[model samples]
Target: MNTGVVTGGWSYVWAAYSLTAGALFLYGVSLFVRVRRIVQ
Candidate 1:
């Protein structure tokens, strides 16, 4: 018998953190590339 229990609070927090980190990284890289292109 397997009980399916889907519930958590930390999982939500982890997801938010991952999303924020990904967005920040992408934004930073895009900004850096744009600046480099503008300088060239």
Candidate 2:
């Protein structure tokens, strides 16, 4: 009955990680742009 439980949980785990990574990527890009403005 619990056959798909592990697989389902893994999908959710990967989704959470992907979302977090995307947010971090955007934040890093914003910081890079801000620093460039200051340096120039």
Candidate 3:
């Protein structure tokens, strides 16, 4: 099987997935920081 054909040229799909993951990670970190500050 050809590697190019295997990927199916869907670059945007991976980018969107990465963007979503980064956003979620940032949000979780922000929430954790806020909770810690409140506890202190």
Model with the higher lDDT, candidate 1 or 3:
1
- Residues 1-40, candidate 3: write the lDDT tens digits: 6556454547888899989999999999999999999999
* Clash count per candidate: 0, 0, 0
True-structure lDDT of candidate 1: 0.94
Worst 10 residues of 1 by lDDT: 1-10
Per-residue error (Å), model 1, residue 7: 8.4
| Model 3 ranges with Cα > 4 A deviation | 1-7
Cα deviation in Å at residue 29, candidate 1? 0.7
**What's model 3's lDDT at 15?**
91
- lDDT score at residue 37, model 1, on the 0-100 scale: 100
In candidate 1, which residue pairs clash?
none
lDDT of 1 at 24: 100
**Two-way TM-score contest, 1 vs 2, winner:** 2
Q: Is candidate 2 or candidate 3 better by TM-score?
A: 2
Cα-based lDDT for every prediction: 0.94, 0.91, 0.89
Error of 3 at 35 (Å): 0.5
| Winner by TM-score | 2
Ranking by TM-score: 2, 1, 3
lDDT of 2 by residue, 11-40 (tens): 888899999999999999999999999999
